[model samples]
Target: MEIDRLTVRFGELTAVHDLTLNSDCGEVLALLGPNGAGKTTTVETLEGFLSPTSGTVRVAGHDPVADHDLVMARLGVMLQSCRLYSAITPLEALRLFASYYRRALDPAPLLERVGLTHRRAIAWRKLSGGEQQRLALALALVGRPDVVILDEPTSGLDVEGRLLVRRIVAELRQSGTCVLLTSHELSEVEKMADRVAIIDGGRLRAVGTPAELAAADRRPEIRFSAPAHLDRAALASHLDATVTQPEPGRFILALEPTPAAIAELTVWLAERNIALSDLSTGVASLEDVFLRLTGEHQPEAKGPGQTP
Candidate 1:
């Protein structure tokens, strides 16, 4: 898959600016961005659901819009939300979707692969959200597609369901399938993606492997969690580094976390009777990089059972 200077607009609003990216066979490329960041617009263009206002897009060397049928044959899409017949059984739904493809995988084994064999006889509406997501994934694989586009593939999944998705993705990579993914799950992206593309305001901000992007942060710092009311000035004086508490109980020290520095910190804390619950020295995380690039405040934690 290749997007070269791709631009998509809706009337006067440019939803996607000049964005260029490519994902190769046997590779998973994750697209990361906040809402309304043009990730959906770009994916829709690749799926032939919308035409690019300017520039070009090619999937498997064929234009998605101009050669929709050819591209559709090799592409499997797992949307975040798709309505299935309320009463359709998982087995029945897979068989029905399988019939649409000339060269489809066996629905039974596909269902098994997604860990839905036990629930195959249950009605679609009777399945839990996680079960439904697994069934949707099975449907995507039934076509044995060369290119798979997964949207929030693990949303609402439990730990076991998430592990199943990871295993399937690993299998896909081993089979030399090109996978394009979009998700807000940064940790999963870090684990599964060969490369990650960060986009904001419809423009590509950065594209690199997780390590590469994280290592680009030259400002390495030591981060720790301790008492909330630690004297910032006193700590800074002790460590001879800049210190700030971005949040209650979380503090950042702008200094290279060398062994001597860590030892000094531990000694200072020990002398002051301050209990350090956690300490780490590293480059910024993907989430931190994302927040810096997108300039958006992180939302409060979600309640249990939230999709993301």
Candidate 2:
């Protein structure tokens, strides 16, 4: 799928402006942005739910607008919120969805894969949120589509449910299916995405692998073990960073990863007779880059978890 200079407008408000991105079989491209950043409009345009006001969108070599039926056949979309018929069982839902496609995967194995086998006979309205999410995922895969577009696929899921999504995404990539997904879970995106596109205010802000974005940001953070009352204000004055103690006996210093800064921090701690143990450094994260481009303040990441 390719979105070339795609633009969408609502009256005088331009929702997505000249957004260009491309993905192919065996790749997972994550679309990330702050609220009101036009990701929804762009994804809807690609999914054929809405026509682009300008520019072009192509899925499997056919224009989505002009070839809606063809694109719909080749694509599976999992929207953020799914409102299924209240009385339908999970088994019934999958069976109904499978009938839509010329050839669909059998629902029995899919139910097991998504951990919904136990809930297969339960009414849709009786399933828990995570179970419902898993069922929605099963429905998305029922068509055996060549392209899958998922929005917040893991939202409201438990650890096991989330792991299920990750496993499925990996399997889909291995099977050479094109996957485009969006999620607020930056940490998961950092781990799963083959490439990431960060957009803000209807414009593409950055696009790269997670490592590339972090390297470009050049804000390295040092985490270490020290007392809670380690004088964060004094440490902040020593480097171009804000130091904090998120837990007792644990300290984090955010700054540019310069040798000079490292030496200065070491020397300062030594002078104060404070033993800074378990020091570790990390590059800027997706959250950091997101905050930088979106002009929003995300809380400091909760961990490097003692460097192991």
Candidate 3:
């Protein structure tokens, strides 16, 4: 999929601004951003549910807006919200949806893959939040679509449910299905996504593998313990780094690059003969890079009629 300078506007407000990104076949590209950051709008456009105000969107070499039917045939979508027959059982629901596709996986195995086989006869309304999410995923996979778009697939899921979802995602990738997922779970994204795109304020900020983004803003971090009476200001002035006291006697430092910040700091501390405790240096994580780029340490605006 490729979106070139894609822009979407609602009245005078721009939901997506000049966004351009692409995903390779069979790869998972995660969209990371807070709510109202245009992640949903971008995905909706690619699914042919909404047309862009300007720019072009191509999915599987077909324009989604212009070739809605063709794109729909090869795509499976599990949106954040879906309406289903509350009275029907899980098996019945899957059968109903499977009937619409010319080629689909067997309903039984599909249910088992999603861990809903045991609840085949349970009413849809009787399932818990996590169960419902899993059912939604099963429905999306019913058609064996070449590309799958999942929005918040693991929301409200317990640890077990989350693990089930991750396993299913891995299986999808192994089968050569391109997966595009939108998620707020940083740990999940870090584990499953082959590449990640950070969107904020309706604009594309950065796109790369988790490691690439972390390396792009690479900084040496040091953690050490000091005496309660030790002057932090004096210690900070002596080292070539910025210090923060996360707790009494515990300091976290971001060292500036100058000839291997870690080595320099080691020499400086050694010169003072100050024995440090619990010191380590490493690159920033996807979560750290995301916080730095978007400045969203929490969720953003809720969708219409949805709770924040």
Best by lDDT: 1
Candidate 2 matches the true fold with a TM-score of 0.84
Q: Which stretches of candidate 3 lie over 4 Å from their true place?
A: 223-252, 256-280, 297-308
lDDT of 2 at 262: 82
Candidate 3 overall lDDT versus native = 0.82
On residues 74-167, what C-alpha lDDT tens digit does candidate 1 reach at each position? 9999886966999999999999989989999999988888888899999999999999999988888888999999988888999998888888
Model 2, residue 76: C-alpha shift (Å): 0.8
Better of 1 and 3 by TM-score: 1
Query: Which residue pairs in candidate 1 have backbone atoms (N, alpha carbon, C) closer than 3 angstroms, thus clashing?
Result: none
The TM-score between candidate 1 and the true structure equals 0.87
Q: lDDT of all the models against the reference?
A: 0.87, 0.85, 0.82
- Tell me each candidate's TM-score: 0.87, 0.84, 0.81
Candidate 1's displacement at residue 305, Å, is 45
Q: Which has the higher TM-score value, candidate number 1 or candidate number 2?
A: 1
Could you give candidate 2's per-residue lDDT for residues 43-108 as a string of tens digits? 888888889888999988888878988988889889889889999999999999999898999989
